[model samples]
Target chain A: MIEFIPSAFAATFSVSVLLALAAGTFAGIIIGALPGLGTVLGLVMALPFTYVMDPATAIALLLSIYVSSIYGGSISAILINVPGTPQSAASVFDGYPMAQRGDGALALGYATVGSFIGGIFSLIVLVLIAPQLAKFALQFGPIETFALIVFALTTIAWVSSGEMLKGLLSATIGLFLALIGPDAMTGQIRFNFDSLFLSAGLTVIPLLIGFFAVSEILYQAAVLKDVKLPAVTSGGFKLAPWSEWKPRIMVILRSCGIGSFIGVLPGTGATAAVFVSYADAKRRSPNPEDFGKGEPSGLLASEASNNAVSGGAMVPMMALGIPGDGGTVVLMGALTIHNVIPGVRLFSQQPDLVTLIFVLLFLSNILMLFIGGFGANLFSRMLRIPTTLLMPLVFMMSVVGAYAIRSNPVDLFVVVIFGVVGFLLRLNRFPPAPIIIGFVLGAPLEMSLRQGLILTDMNFLAFFASPIALILFCITGLIILNLFGLGNAISKRFRRKETQSNN
Target chain B: MQQKNADMLYGAVLAGMACAMFAHTFSPIYQNEFLFGDVSTVFFPRVLLGIIFVLSMMLVVKGKLSTSDAILTQINVKRVLLTGGATLITVVGVWYLGYLVMMPVGVFLIGLALGYPNLVILGITSLISPLVVWVILAKFAQVSFAPGTLL
Candidate 1:
């Protein structure tokens, strides 16, 4: 696989791939800087173009957009207090303050450098860990796989929505949606209401466009009160002296580690990582009072950790075929369109493609650093583009994207239907990501469970006999116990009993 | 509406839907041939529907006992309906009128519905953006677009 690096580089340096990298980076930055069009929507809009692209070029484009879009969010965060993406929500704490004080260029410098380091750190983690994880996954039989999917879904649901019950309900709904098409093992169509279109099953792309893009448009329409653009802070790029950055080196490294670790976990995404890293950075800072007042360390921790998540989130998606967040879900969907199925088999079967992905991610980060620095002012200017104007364009792209895939007019309706469904669900405080995760993992979960059951000759309890499956199920049980507050209650009772005994 | 009331209502609706779906799983369309002994085609879906039913019931219980005073966000129902209606019309328009002919109109209509202030800019962008996109996607990328039957 190491030998494939040279070939990967040769492939990446091709005119077509390089063009894709540049265009993806440029478009991603603008999309990110503009509030309301974040990484998922950026990828959704880019999906139609990928229909004609070769796999390599398509992956290059998506990878660049994914990496750069995360970085692009800081532009809006710094220039205006509005975060362009949810992942960058923490960036505004210190970034906007710095810009308010006319150090916007220096702030941009810190964010760009921190994002680069974080990206590189995560890429290294990805390169080292993904293959090893994939190798470990090869040992999993159907029982273990079922256990793993259940655990992953549980963890995802627990963290996605604030309310555990709502999250679980959302996930269950998603699972039901996946079951609507047909049963894979028995060739029996279960929930299709006798329509011809119902038998073929739903495709991920249209579902994605509906849930992430069209639903967003409807949500925005419902909530948007002000069409006026926020005032932009001055933006430029100026690298801070080494003396200024030297003290923050530890903060950057700590944030990179935090982001990478959190990113590797299923369902917890960069948003979680950034806030956690920010709090940790503040806790350890000597000048904690200055933390939110244009503190470079705070900015560094927020920016670095969020960007680092770009690499960390891919680990589960690439290694286990489990998406960590909406961005990766869209990425996974795109990869499937190109017939590049991600999972335990992907590492062994297509080492070359994996190597190319690594190279592409590495190049994307590098491109982000250069492009982010040079294009800071331009991105700040783009913040003036109102959501009112941008959303119509998104809607158009949604229509085109849905129709372009398989050329089915029914898919257009799928986009509209899911769009409304997604919007309604969101209005009711149901988190959308778990639904997608549930949908994606639904088929595999059913297959693995049935297969495991067959292997055990209908002895359901035999699933627990596998040590790996047992451990996974135990963890899931603990999570469920915690969700119900039983874990905490039991621990508190035990502690009280211990105190009484000591007395 | 209060958050609790909304949740209870949503849960009841979902529970009802789940019950309907669960019953439908036993319909003859499923072909209930059990090649794997106990596992039939409807087996997994039944399990899922059952989970949904239980979860929704729990949601209703939780909502009934909830003490929080949080209210649901004030939604502009008229705007949501208008925007959704505009989107559906756009899709239907594209179906009959073709991508090249109806897309610009769709974009313009959506923009107007979303309350874009600058009509001139909206008109220009709505007209030109789709044309540019079509040119690039259709001509350069060799992707096909629906030509309107009416056109």
Candidate 2:
């Protein structure tokens, strides 16, 4: 890892890193301020623009947005009960309560600081760990890479909202949906008909936007037309003093460290990290009673860890070609479209650009302090923005973002279909992220595993032979047990109370 | 829907998916190519189909909807429209307007849907977001995209 200073590289950003970060941070905040507009959706929306820019700038912008959006989400969660992004779900545990008690300013202040701390920690991790991971990744082959992907996918069930069966079912749905286009192995196409677009397979970005963004909007519009915005005292300023923050520093760091580590795991995103950290903090605290009753530490822990996930997710993506989440999936796709290949070689091949990106992520997270600092106040003001003016604009951006992915109307239709599927599933308690997991992994999982299977002469059960595979299997098994009612006893044994609200 | 009916519907979806697999499996195109003593590429999907079929059956009998109706009620229509509209926008935007214009437009629309109205805020959001995308995707990453006719 290079002991690089982001400030030293600011002058070099004329190559587009500065512009990317500026633009990315701006969009990230807006997306985060709005409830349910996720970073994946935001990045997918931005995919088209990358076609015209430099890869470093493109990555910087994307990374910056990814980082800032994670933090921006707390604005809504803290000021209003609704989490702007799912990762901020834990933020509401205390964030909203604080607001309810007319401490909205205090909550935002603590959350902003916590998020800044978390983001910085994760970026530092990216600097320290990413290169090491890249070094280790060089030792991997198709077998190791495949094992890693499997491990990531298995985490879906573990990190899923509730019910491993549903999570597994959700993963199954994603895997199948992925099969709808081409046969990756042969030159032949499998699911496509005469439609010209079918030969290329469904674009993942449009699918993500539809399922996560458009579908979410449709569901919200259909039901929450008159969402009750919580009472607010215009929370745009910092309410907590330095002294109040001093005590929570350790808690924030611990949360960020935990969050960053989990974020690197893929599937286990910031939301899960936040909830887990909050629970851990609460359990370890002498003042456990302070938690869930508008305690600053709980919110601090939640924000710190979730923000940290931004950096953590990048480790695997940079080291291996495996993108850790939907956001990185889009980033990889965008880069591929730009001809920027990832893997162990990317660092050595494009050290300047890659290093530039590392520094940009660092700068973006640190800059987030300023962006998030003032952004918190401005976002709090957004609660008063009339939806009459609000929703149409959101619809507009999603529509535009969808179009950029492939410039295909068919993709738009897919988005709508996925949106409907997402809505129905949400009603049925089906999480949309799994659909993405399915789509993202769909072709790769089938094609790769099939190749591995064929190479092993249909041993079929070769999946279980490897040590890594066994560990992944265990994780999947644990997730299944946890996601289902099967692990309730074990979980109860592990903890005294189940006060950790499921996000 | 009642638990019984929901379970039935889920089972049907799984069953249909399984049938789709069987069609692919038994078809001459696949079965005729019996590579490696009748074990070939179709095995993976076939295995998947079998697993899905089993899972579906389990749902038909032992499966529970898990979520209470009250929770379902909260997921409502606006969320659906928002997600649907965003998808429609992204898919259609790329097809019609240039990618340059479409990126900002998508951001604005998503921002709008989530309840941000001030044109200035929306404009800043729309413009800035695309530029970032353009720089990363176009400039740094070295990938190409669908630039609209206007550009």
Candidate 3:
């Protein structure tokens, strides 16, 4: 792994790769700085172009977008009261106040430096841990693998946006959708209704375009009755004095740790991490009341933790093939498009590629710090691009992406149908992430379960024979219990801790 | 018109769809009874459908208990329907007409339907975007486009 660092750099430093990084990161920041657009939307829009690029170039492009977008969101949070992304919601607590007090430049400085530190720290953790985690995952058998997928599926409840049952229903719908084509076990078609296109099964590209792109267009069109945001003037970076920052170093480090840990939990996204880190920072700060009041520590906690989550969220996706959140789910899809299936198999089959991904991620963050610092004002101007104009361009991209996948006219209908359904689902608070999770994991879960069942001679309880499987089952059971009421009890305890911290 | 109790309506629709899907999974078209696998093809789907059915019922109950958010808040339904109709026309246009002829027109119509006030910008963009995409993806990258029979 140490030796490959140089080789990884070699692969990543090529003209094409660097160009991709520059383009993706720049566009990502602009998208993130815009109020309505976000990291996920940026990623979804970029997916169309990856159909033509190589694996390394594609990953480089997507990783650049993923890392920089979190940082970009803070720019808006500081310059204006709005958080460009959900991950930046905590940043608004202090970021806006700093801006309100005419210290917006200083706030941006803290966020930039803090984000840089958080990104690098998480990368270090990723480099140290991902290979080992993947190695451990390779030891799992069919039953254990199935149990792990079940655990991963249960994580849908975590990022369900406060609607767990609706999330489960969406996942179930995804499973049903995945079952539409021919049976993998047997070569028989199931739910095609005699259509040639359905017989081939729903392609990932069209489904994603529908779910993320076209649906977003419809939703925005429906809901955007008026545009009301005022343009903000971005100021240059201004760091706090050393003595002022000395006390907050521990807050930054601890928040990174918190961010990384929470990010590794599937479906517990950066939004959650920022909140947890903010609460933790407030708890430890000597001047707790300074939080949400232009406090440097508050900005550091939010920016550091959210940026840290970019690396941490990739852990499970890279090591175990389970997406930790919506963004990684799309990345996983991108990998599949490039013929790089992300799992334990990826590490063994293509270690060089994996190393290159790590190297690219590191470079992306380093570039983000400089590019983001230099381009802050330019990114702020992105907010002026109206949704009216932006939505139309995105629609064009979606059409091309869907059509380019198979050049089938029927796929356009697929995009439209799913787009409509996805819009309705969003309105009902059934989050889209769970549906993608269910779709991505559907085949593996079914295959593993069926194989395990065959191996156990149809005895269901025999799946628990493996210690790994047993442990996973126990964890799943506990999660179910938590879903009922235990989670609320735990959250109440945390709330009490937060209240004490505020005092 | 205002959509009152949108959550309850959504729940009821979801339950109906789930029931329909559940029933469909049992249809003769999906049967794999003679297969030798431990689980039939229908087995997993049936389980998923059943879960969806139960969850939708739960959603209905939840919808009844809780006040619904503004799922349809100030949304111009007429605009939505028109845009949807325009999208359908775009798909059909691309199917019946070739990419070169239909794509720009489709894009322009879509932009117009979405209430873009500047027809000049919408028309210019509609024309330019498809051509640019075609040149980049189809011309440069060797991606094939759907050339309708009319072409």
User: Candidates' lDDT values, in order?
Assistant: 0.91, 0.70, 0.82
TM-score pick, better of 1 and 2: 1
For model 2, how does the per-residue alpha-carbon lDDT over A1-503 read when each residue is reduced to its tens digit? 24344533854458466767887897887777677566876776666556566666777778878888888788888776778888898998888888788888788888877888888888789878888888876765545556666666667644667545566677777777676656666545545545677767777677776777656566666665554454545577575878887887789888988999998886677877988999989988889997888999999999999988888888877766667666776777677766777668887676665777677777887777777777666667765554434444444445545654555556657767777777676666667776676666667677667666666776757767767666766776676565446688877855655455432
Models 1 onward score TM values of 0.98, 0.81, 0.92
DockQ of all candidate complexes:
0.76, 0.29, 0.57
**Error of model 3, residue A94, in angstroms:** 1.9
lDDT of 2 by residue, B46-145 (tens): 7667767876776666445435433225444464566456646665666667567676767666656655536696778678766765676567655455
| Model 3 chain A lowest lDDT segment of ten | A227-236
* 2 versus 3: better DockQ goes to: 3
Model 2 spans > 4 angstroms off: A1-12, A96-106, A225-231, A239-241, A292-294, A341-353, A386-389, A461-465, A474-503, B31-39, B64-71, B74-151
A262 Cα displacement, candidate 2 (Å): 2.6
Residue A79 of model 2 has an lDDT of 75
Instruction: Tell me how far the alpha carbon of residue A102 in candidate 2 is from the true structure, in angstroms, after superposition.
Output: 5.8
Order the candidate numbers by lDDT, best to worst.
1, 3, 2
Return the DockQ of model 2: 0.29
Please, what are the lDDT tens digits per residue for candidate 1 over residues A1-503? 89999999999989999999999999998998899999999999999999999999999999999999998999899989999999899999999999999999999999899999999999999999999999999999999999999998888888885677788888888877787776788766657787889888888889889999999999999899878878999999999999999999999999999999999999899999999999999999999999889999999999999999999999999999999789999999999999999999999999999999999999999999999989887888889999989998999889888988988888999999999999988998888888887888889999998998889998889999999999999999988888778988999999999999999
Clashing pairs in 3: none
Task: Report the Cα interface RMSD of each model, rounded to 1 decimal.
Answer: 1.2, 5.0, 2.1
